[model samples]
Target: MAKIENGRKSVDTRSIRTISSSHIDDESSLGSDSEINGFTSDRQTDKYGFIGGAQQYSEESAQDVPTEVLRQREVKWLDMLSHWDKWMVKRHNKVRLRCQKGIPPALRGRAWLYLSGGKVKREQNQGKFQELDSQAGDPKWLDVIEKDLHRQFPFHEMFVSRGGHGQQDLFRVLKAYTLYRPEEGYCQAQAPIAAVLLMHMPAEDAFWGLVQICEKYLPGYYSPGLEAIQLDGEILFALLRRVSPIAYRHLEKHKIDPILYMTEWFMCAFSRTLPWASVLRVWDMFLCDGVKIIFRVGLVLLKSMLGTREKLKACQGLYETMELLRAIDARYMQEGFLVREILELPVTAREVEREHHSQVKRWKKIRGELNFKSPPRMHGARFIMLAEPPRRQDLQQNPTIVVEASQPTPQLKKSKEEKSKKKKSVKKKQPIEEIPNPYPLLSDPPPPPKEPPAPPPVSSEMPQIPQQTLIDSPQQEHPPPTDLSLAKESPLQQSTQSLSSTEQDTYL
Candidate 1:
């Protein structure tokens, strides 16, 4: 028997009986059936549809943001969607602001697709998901995936039944990811992330969304060794020292590892930890702002729980600290309050990057060489140009070529001069002629034709005015093309045309 110190008490590890694999497998197989029969009825569910009594701290209780405000935000998001490329390129700050405010739930899934560049990835890799879905994935990974299927959101109505469509779709998504990335296979943490995506989008879209998360947004997070997360753990610790030194000192005193608490928090992106509403809000910012949001959230939680001496006094040892972190108070998880805290927190991407470099160097110095190799973390959405509104420069360069009727060119000037000379010379010789009118009105005859307005007195030499040319100007070698096809075409078509040949072939 091994004893571990727990502040004022000591606990025997041998007393913690570990369940056998057979027992765990048996429970896994019966999980859905047990949940369905035990408690998952329509009557017994929260507003969010979890098979439990209504939550004490609901989204409404967190902060009752007016419906009109959400509606207005929805409108702004719609506009952003239409001009996605422009927003991503030029007005990304606005995107960040809107994401921090919270993506309207109605638009959350679609916005996630755009924000994560999943839509573009899906468009680029058309039919790939179907191919992967059709094939049988590796048996090894499939078995592991199957065991975890019921474990993900078993209480939710979607996954309550044994082998329900939700579970089937979830399986397809996870299995497809295995085939798509055979080397990494699947991680248990991925199931909840994929489940969250499947709740909002189709299986294929969810698959691509998962791809973006794995490959881009949070690269190397689900790899075999989880080296990226380990590195981030160090980085998070370094940051915590600055953000909340009291919490830092408390953990240091207990000789606690950051991984013990933060693994699930970072790997699952807090889906399992935070309230459902706050989870969605965090995802909104995460997908929009990338992994920095995850770091900030972790720091905020640490600070909120153990920042002050009074809070740290309660967590006397590793056990108490772990317990406090695992079962965070519901008050701290409130959506509005949490989001406000996260946004106000001063953790920036630059700081995260700087810390990452420092930690990487320290690791290399200690370990001799790094073992894992993963792609660089993507900050936000992949920089794909979408159908965007015309830029001010583009509009300025090819302005509407309107030629005023009063502004005569040099060529027209000669003709006008000739006509004026003839009219003056013939003024005495040609009298107004009035033959019989074809349709005479009963009303008094119309007044005689007014004399033509006299031309302005002709100067001996015309003022040296520069010739104004509408088309084929001498100065312009090639006049701007007047196709306006881009302006006329829908945003989608423009986005398609804007794609490079490689991108078109790859995506389209």
Candidate 2:
């Protein structure tokens, strides 16, 4: 009968739950008081209650430039925030460019919250997240969520240790998601992305921000099958071929798969792949621009690593190619320069639309042929291309058409099985020795044929005691099959002679 105030309305939190007797974990008592205070040590407590990270602000660590320049940018951002509604409508281009430059860490959280519509969503879905947090999550997804918490940002100060404030908050956020969107459940990628979000905002704000991201920015991405990620990889490859043909050719020649490098880049929204500074900058643009930022960032990294002829020549094999791509020069990945390159790239919304349509069709066709609803077995593993020629058609007129290779007919499989049976029957009649023995030195008999289940009286474990039965009950075990003609050909004639009888009866 607890009264909960949500926006203008007062509602009982207990009314949302089915069971009255269910025990709800006290959300407030999950973390230690010191760790709780530590999480908001960076931000002004009077201004932001419990929604920010423990990011310390020294004069030196404030910005990447002089205080004066940082102050000017901060002023512009403040003005923008003041007139956020009007500026978002009228000066979107200006807002986008400013975001590309990088949001100051002091104002970054608010900017991301505003850009991602977290604030509005929070107000609209008031107390919904708190209700979700109170419910116990599915054990299936909770275990997976627990496993991925430490794996999210192992080096980040907040998430560095297990059972810390950061880890506890991360667990609550992800667990709430599994309860909120039960169909989507908990995805491995969502953990790192949610951890990044929690670094900027409180659990409630982060939950809403994550909702906007999973639904608006990355729809159909973190579902059970992960169809969006696979389709995007195909689209990215197509864009790569158009944007940097030479680099594309080098990758194709080396068999460097898109899956190898692109999985974490797209799945975690580049949180795991890029440098910290660049990662924050990218996150800013990613929140504003949607998934295109992801494709552009991916293209930039690939083009930088493989774009140069000298770089391509230096990579001798798959391992070298992976190493070069994995280890991008930090100097080159500076936020200012990298964002500029990404913005300048020729990738467009219309082009992505075209590619998406084509790739989706291709995906459906392949799925139909292979009957593969889930991601491929080794979709995350890197594979070397063993010298396949790169296709160089202009994407404008002749987009790559992915025709699904027809599967082998059932008749063909049946014919093959019939042929194998005939071979075995022929081998069985060729009098054991006259036939060329595949294993001449080995005397083990062929394995028994698989048959339908028999009566329950026959024991399944009797096969292991074959030799003991032969010695113990020699007279009773079919009288050694009066085969005088075949007995002289082999030393183990009795055992070999009884092989057929043993297989025919289930008791044997």
Candidate 3:
């Protein structure tokens, strides 16, 4: 065995050395020479088709645990995996408790597949990833994804070098997704998420897990529009008022907006914000639970960051407040205490759902009232129009437009040259199929911008803030991203045409 740098060490490369005269007997404990040499890599994987990374077992953190204890935990988890369905059905609470405690590293890959319904999704969508992988992705998104690949966990062992296995797998998974779901295209946030998944499982499995995340756990989240994020930002604001008034008031007073901090937390699932260990623990629970874990984790971060009125009052501006939140001490987010606090939070999933619906309705009404010349933009997704969730049959039949940006008002006065160019372009127009207007509200153009309303009064005593009046300006209503959202498509649904901002300090 030899020592490695950065507190990471390597396993003994000489473990596989053998002699020709060596003989095996029934009395011997070793099953075979290959088994003694760790099953020659092939059999190293368990029954679940997951090849446990050798690096995971040699980490300094693993060294801290007693060997016997680690082995026993792995054995227990292996037994659970053996009877996964029975255990889940008969002891759902126990399963959740185990997940909250954290899945054993040896078993995390298979456990994630099972917990996120990745296994089932993979089975149902057999060969979908391969098919998607074969196709070239939308070049517009491929360039963006390529730039972000090296940026995602650059220091981690898997992604440390350029064109490494981790980066390659991440590229394949993200590229496959862009082809699979042309509507959503590529979002920068999806890079870190896919990178994390690749560390736990193969690229194919990672792709399915990402899909489950997009469709099941957090619908409308990663798409160009980021509609879910905008709605959820309001939900967070409303929830914050109830959970920690002092913190909320401090933010309002300082003009610190939810979009400033919440986008990274929601988009990356806190992968970049929290320490690696804490991020893994959050992922363990997040896969088991759903997006609510994100909300719970976010509340804990806020409380820890601004736990006291004094701390909240001490903050002076958006930059200072965002920095305070981003630099939360790692000790505060330790899995043990953070999970317990999250469990004790006053908010519930049901409450979150209620708030989401209320906020959405409020957003629709605001759009109708303001009729702003420009539609609201959050991340990539545009606020084209509001519509009820279409029925499943309708979605399958019509492939409804889930997101679309309102066309900017055309310039009325054009130069003679521009007119001539427009006429020539019309003459060469290709036959583009027009998608029928999906919603009545979007059919009519917005009215002229109305007079801006008076700013809402801020009060800790008030539980529900008027959604439209929460921010001083529409720009504040949807905070700008540190990175630009993908802007290659005209509108995104199941499939559609292509159609073509932000200030940020301390975005993770």
Candidate 4:
């Protein structure tokens, strides 16, 4: 191969070969072979592009980002910062020099495509997507997504109606996304984010936007092979500590895991909690800001709930705890105040992002050094029904049915052999010793059952309501599940109870 001084590709045609088979030198056979070769010339031949040429074109196109447009962008950015001081303005200007300015909401789709530096990512992703699309429209998709369809945005109106377009698109995007990423497959919160996108944009554009989120924003949140979300959760909580010290301290005090509240936030891009108006507004920043706002918004929500969290400590019951989250609305009364406060926080979006990245680096450093061992007893799906043995009969006479205390797993065969050996060893010895490696570690105790307080010793003095009014009293306190409580009462009923954040974090 000879080098080209001008950096042009030097194609060596000597390596190119044409097929000419058949030992026949007969005139008719030669003519037929020639005819076949002539037909081959009409078919398309693969052409290769020069890497050097591509680079040259890229540089030239990058350089041609019109000077006038760039100047206007600078002006627009400067105009938005008119309220800021000189120092902040200069810092903003410096950052904008490298990063592109955020696109207006009207042009979000095109802008997101360009900003993500994925001009051809769509075409490539779509090709992979088309291969998966052939397997779509399965009945299982509706059943699977339906189970989680309401679960994702329990508080939202758009996904309230399962057969609604809002939810229908949400399901399609999730199903398509799952089909595309079979390794990660379907996760819990993606449908909510898709619903959020469908609220403002068409389904296809929203689908592409979801593709960008899965690829760029929330990198490994859904992958079974990757535990990045669990790892990043630590970093997010740390940011919460800095941003909302009181809430962080409360979580520390109570053992409330951030995963209880913020898991949905990180997984769904705040679609689970934030109001639609605020969610759409935050999404504008989220696309440009990546997942930084998720952390910030978490801090903001925690701060907003400061008053409510304190009130929560006074509440003595499970119903009361759920009532707090179910009734809490971050936008107007609950989160809106915190959002306003967060916008005024001393940290810049860039600084917060830098801190988030630094924290991630720290997490990676620790993950390498530390052994994150999961508890042995933790398993999925299978739940035990604790039934007590009948005590009426004597131990010898009892129709005793012993429940197999140990659940079978893939590792059960080896465990069974070990158990048999232990039995033999015990039988051979006069003195029996406690077995050390008996089974997977004892399971965590289940939450205590909620038993209605023994009906207060019937007070004959208390007047019972007439049958008609009797029905109305409980109805007033807790409405039919159909009439969703959008105001103050609604969220409380829908909320799930969690351990105090403080305890959860310390243990986590």
Candidate 5:
């Protein structure tokens, strides 16, 4: 056992250096001798390859969800991705429900790409990331980002080695963003966000994913003064009043500011606060549902920790409350329970918006005017609107099929000139059937279906149109196709077929 010196256990510097040197890979890019000292020991890691602290994954958590169930969810998610636009336009509620259930881990990266609109952004801004990456970023932001590199997920194997590929990729992504949005420069909060994105995607893909998070999902969040976070902090406090009056009173009585505790939680999206599995689960919902999910999660944590008098009794003073919020109970942090609590919380987007308006009014009253000019915060995945799929007309036009009437009887026939005149006259008299447009302009509601004109009184004198033509016409309603072969194929096969060629190219 190591000896205790003064009130702390003393670590042997020589032994640590020897162990670290022995474990160091020759290929590792760690340059400085001091940096090499920061490497972690080859301690056993959890299933997710995270070292030390409480293990987020265990045999029990794994058994909590069965393999077959996970398989079913993955299949459902693939089908959803195949029809992403349709789901976003018409069935967003179903999408939200599936997200709440927990996205399949294997497909989380792709789902995040889709939900956050990162894939669309990447496609739209092709070569933009590479352009930013090629330039040397501003030295100020680069220096700060470099220092914070290893601080992100240091316990995880991917970032364990100093100057390793993970840190290198993290550097590229964050530096690229500083170049991409020079005004915002860089925020420490963004480092962890980019790090999390890089874990699941390529550097370019992660950059765009970070872009969506910074610009669309949580706008103004990482700006220099963090004004948006402050606004959200007030919004969270206002919301807490409704969510848990007891918790609200406790915080108010102790003069505990929401920003003090929530800045890290909201800024990092709880990556540091929660267990690894729980973090992924929260992210899955956050991307789909947007910042409201984050608000609800914060409310849940506050209520769970301090809602009751008995719970608050121990948290009597400011330090106690802050400590409790900082080091949340393990039981309260469980993935399943936390998710349930979040879902059960009654906070809504409208309430948050209303509270935001109120807070802005109060801020103006107190401080006269706002200082920063931040863009409006988007509530959720409104980016779907910008990336909507093209209409049927925008794609290849349907080939026009001409249907010929049966040949007229010889007696009915006339001279060649007369026959042509009669044919022209007959065509002018016939009513043209209107095909209803399936893809209607989003701004306007689809016109009600028109009833098929009563079949012209069938007469021996009239040429008969083929019944098959009417049955197969675009106007006719047909049940959606169900392919037995597609059903027999595995989820992976279905996903490949469902994704368009272009989508498959950029999905990674």
Candidate 6:
């Protein structure tokens, strides 16, 4: 029973009246407005509104960035990697401190390799990345990564860019890594990891970082058994208890599990969850602190989840619970508020080792007892559906085409609401006028009727997605989700769903 402040119900019905008047006599904005709804209801690659085209993802000028930019990036990365030479441990230490603070924006690319020690390894070991990239066997990760891609960070601009070039590039880097590390081949988590890499470093450097995963570190993480992914979850849990106890107790009480959420964090190495702007910050610590930061971020996420423990336990399925742990604000969680909580985590090497061994044993034990379903498997498919090649325009802007449904929306009389999509500040989900033939549904209205002229066409500036094949296998699996952009809906709905990701005025 909400009461109106002005006894006369000070509601200004002017806008409403103006809207109906504008539409009844004209064919202005009705279709445009509804088009937006249709857009948001479908899955759009440009989830972050990075590029607003209904087109598929593609590149800008592939002619090249002048070998100079590539060379400069290459030489610079080599130098950065070389700095980790035998005589340069001090240089590595200094770089470590700089990373502790944060890698400078311009230096991020080079710093990435220097931080990962990838540069040194490549310099020290040639034919390694190629060897790993080409080393062949059945890739075990295709299925899991694909499923997670849709949910990993549905809100991030980079991953959600309506199957644009950026998204395709992400897939390429990770796919290459799988080829390079036959052991880790095509894991879902790698997409985000590569995402973080591609954002901060050049493709080559990022590629090497992927190699480094199998080179010295991460043997168990990507090991064949799904063994690494699961066992590490246990190891990470122990690590969290040692680092932050407050987050631990709360998690323990709620019986929350970090296994499901850790997939994204561990898989992408934080690229999937954190904002691109903030990834360098996380990367800085990751480089300087080693693998410990991964565990710390894990604990921090769990600790943050303590607040929603009860609600989390009640989740009907794994997906909802997964999103909750992801929603934890780490900045607030680790601001020294969990000092007491940190004390409760298991810290001793023996203690962790005992738990780790037991956990690993359980993975083995469960093999005979309960059947844990393996993640989805991706068998490369090329031309599984009606796929197309990239065009020049799509390269710069998204090019994904809508697979129109067989049933089209019913045609009705023109209305003012349709005009709203053309307006700059488009809002999604606004109720549409439902009247059936308000003005006239002309079967063959005056050629292209004047009383009801059509609205302006929808447009976008997003990059297009590129087609690719597996490194060694001839199987050409088309990226099912990457082929579509925001075109599936009207510009209005796409813009509205996009706006939710950012706090900005709808200049549309």
Clashes of 1: 1
Q: Per-residue CA lDDT of candidate 1, range 83-147, in tens?
A: 77777789988998898888888888888987877777776676999999899889888888878
Q: What's each prediction's TM-score? A: 0.69, 0.61, 0.60, 0.45, 0.69, 0.45
User: How many clashes would you count in candidate 6?
Assistant: 57
RMSD (Å) per prediction: 19.7, 29.2, 31.3, 34.6, 18.9, 33.0
For 353-394, candidate 5 gives per-residue lDDT tens digits of 888889889989987677765766666664444445434332
Higher-scoring candidate on lDDT, 3 or 5: 5
Q: Which is better, 2 or 5, measured by lDDT?
A: 5
- For residues 291-344, write the lDDT of model 4, one tens digit per residue: 665666666665666535565475345444445544555243233343455456
**Of candidates 5 and 2, the better by TM-score:** 5
For model 6 the TM-score comes to 0.45
Q: lDDT tens string, model 3, 1-508?
A: 4445333333222211121223323212544323332334454542212234322222222214476877877887777766655565577667777777777787787778767766666766668888898887787887787778657765455554334456667888988888888877888889988888888888998998887677666777776667678778888888888888878878788877688889989989888776555677788878766677888888888877886877866677788888888777666766566767877887766788788769878988875432221222211000000111222232121222567767554563346568999888986774444443222222244345456555545455433333332222223233322111212212352132111001111110
C-alpha lDDT of all candidate models, in order: 0.74, 0.65, 0.63, 0.46, 0.73, 0.46
lDDT sort, best first: 1, 5, 2, 3, 4, 6
- Residue 422, candidate 5: Cα error in Å is 41
> Which digits, one per residue and each the tens of the lDDT, describe model 6 over residues 347-426?
43345446666776776777653233333211111110012222222212112386765753444223344565545354
User: What does the lDDT come to for candidate 5?
Assistant: 0.73
For every model in order, what is the number of clashing pairs?
1, 2, 7, 16, 0, 57
